[model samples]
Target: MKDFVSVIITAYNRQKYLGYALNSVLNQTLDKDKFEIVVITNFEFNKPNYKNIIDIYDNQEYLGEKIYKGLHESKGDIICLLDDDDMYREDKLERVTSFFKTFYPIYYHNNFVTIDDKGNEIKIIEEYLKIPPYASFNLPEFTLAIENNRKTDIRNLLKLNVNFNSSSICVRREILENNAQYLRKIKAVIDSFIFYSSLLLEGNILLDPARLTYYRIHTLQTSSGNTKNIKEYKDSFSNLFKKAVEDFYIITEMLNGKINENILEIVNEELLRYKLLYKIFSGNNILIKTKFNIHLLNYYLLSLLPTFLGNLYIKDQYNRTKKVRSFQVKSSNIF
Candidate 1:
């Protein structure tokens, strides 16, 4: 029988935490034969002798490319991605497989807990999600209802009001296969590409309320680390805004007739708002050369305000959407 799930872990210079992540997978409640682990690392290290582990090394340092390679090498009906610094709860795989058998969602994910570098719990995933208390539905039902109600989940996704952690997501292999063309076009933000493309292609997403993964937040992690200067902060936000716009266009073109027109309009409005903010904070000279509009006027007016006030606004917005921990942890022995 073919493997039921493939867990793909992409690691780069995180050997200190990789072993714990691997051990978490090895300790899953599911039978060893039901799932396989594929690790793509950028390190040359001693390899473990686990029979179910497949290791691939890439020296090029492209995260998206490594993920693409992992998908290509995966040989299972379902695919689950994990980051080397994060870990799965022992029953995550077993529960996910069982949920699939029951609801048959094309895409699925569970809530996750946030931890500090030393493995202390910072906050539960629900603290950040915009979902209402006690609101729950099966994946297929939710998707159908959303369409019937003339609402697109894509809006919530773009606003970072929903969870799309690569580590907590499990998708059908066929979804990835069908979207391989667009996936290859991605050089960064691979997780957003997969999530948006799959949903646009009419895949239903199931969100399990159980916190089944531990997402670690530390100084060395890519997204949350290394922003010591104003230039770094501006550059990071600029790149993020650019990628969000790119993904929006890519999905729009790929799912032309399938997406709602109103949804497209809404996304465009949001993009315009982001563009104005990007112009103000990014300090990119090219943005000033573009056609001016009310958004640009608003940006100019905002620029005339006290610098501290503009900075406060930006800081507030960043805190609302960033994946970094909202609270500090003082102690824990969980690791």
Candidate 2:
């Protein structure tokens, strides 16, 4: 019998947390036969029982390629991703299967809690996501309604501040299989690529409010591990901004004329802001001739301010963003 869900847990040198992640799957409320675990790791770790697990060892260091391999080898109707350092709640699989059975969305994402390395909850995921509390869980039944104006809906959703962590996202197997080629092209921002690709493909998405995954925040985490200074921070943001622009164009090209022009303008404006900041910190004059919006102009004027004030302003803004990007939850709340 075919498996109902395939949980792909990709690990790279995170052997310490792999056991916890794998055990979370094995201890799920869902039947053992209903789901299979696929472990894609570079090194062997103490995994759970081998009965329902498929361990694929690839010496290749790229995480994107490892994930692609797992997706290719997976044999299930639904695809769920688990980061090696993150874990699902015991009922995550159960809730996901139930939701899929009832509504059958192409993509499903649930709220997740952020945890520190010591396994203490720092803050609720919804707090960081900033999604409107009133956004309904069940989307409209008409796929065309979502497809015809996805760009606008997506822009509005982003404005409300949405986030997509891989462990919190699940996709129908067919969607991943269909988009595998495009997905393979992405190296670092695979999660963002999958999220936007699903939207552009007109795939219905179900955003569950329940916190179902434990996202661990640590110094070694990929996004947090690299930035030791302002230069690194600026480079990171620049790369992200460039990737967003690239993805925007790719999705636009794929959608033809179906995309909203207003959404394009919104993205362009956001990109301009990021570009201006990048120029400000990097001391680059590339954007000097570009048309300036109020936000960009403000940043420019701040960059020209007295050295102490400008540095203070830049440091304050950068530190605020770094905290968010690094998943530093300032709250003492525990879930």
Candidate 3:
């Protein structure tokens, strides 16, 4: 029998957290027969002989392909994603199922709590996501309105450009299958791909404010695993930018390169921000040829002015910095 929800858990060799992540699903308040656990991993791990039938797909492939494989194999109409290092709250599946039924959103992202490697919750933390615009009182969730033109939809979503934790992501199966092309190219920026594709395909997105998943933070993540200095930091930022650029390119292909006008304008601004920061910190020449928006006035000055003047500005900022070792060099002048 087809399940109502397929909780697809993508894992690697992390034996430590996989059990906890799986147990979280097993412990869900939802009926065990209503939802099935689909484990996709490269290696064969211990699968608990539980009442809920858990299917395993063991293969070695890249991140995108692995996700595609799981999506292809899931038997449920509603797909819920759980990363290997993350765990879901016991009520998450129940809430997510109801959220989809009422809102009928193609993509759904619930809020999540950040936890350490030891499962301790972290408070007062800086987060990667912004509060979704449409989520408000009484509603307490977000649903993107696509009442405008395609260009407007693209522009507004790209402007917002908010991404949440992967484990908190859920979607209707057909939307993901129809847009699997975008998923194929994605490696590490899965959240961005899912988000942009949902908007690109004109599917409504729902963002729930409820914390339904536990997003694990550790020193093992690729971006923070081995970063040592400003140079490494620059490299890491560059890598992340590259991944996002790939997503943009995939979108361009989807639109047959027609939205090139301002589609990449936001991405280009982010690139300039990185280059501008790198030059200021490394004592190098700022890329004066690149353009910046009005909000980035200090960056605009750094690029528009002469090379020597830009260097002086960098030096000035460096001198005023409270701690150079901390990479907390303060912002540059505006006027």
Q: Give candidates' CA RMSD values in order.
A: 5.6, 5.7, 8.4
Error of 1 at 229 (Å): 5.4
Output the better candidate (1/3) by lDDT.
1
- Candidate 2 versus the native: TM-score? 0.73
Best by TM-score: 1
Q: Which ten residues in a row have the lowest lDDT in candidate 3?
A: 128-137
Q: lDDT per prediction? A: 0.64, 0.64, 0.60
Cα RMSD of predicted structure 3: 8.4
* Tens-digit lDDT string for candidate 3 (42-125): 777788898555656666434566778787776898888888888999999988777677767777777776565567665422
| Model 1 CA deviation exceeding 4 Å by range | 1-3, 60-62, 124-163, 225-234, 266-277, 285-326
TM-score between model 1 and native: 0.76
What order do candidates take by TM-score, descending? 1, 2, 3
Give the lDDT of residue 24 in candidate 2: 84
Pairs of residues at least 3 apart in sequence or in different chains that clash in candidate 2: none
Ranking by lDDT: 1, 2, 3
Any idea what lDDT model 1 has?
A: 0.64
Using lDDT as the yardstick, the better of models 2 and 3 is 2
Clashes of each: 0, 0, 0
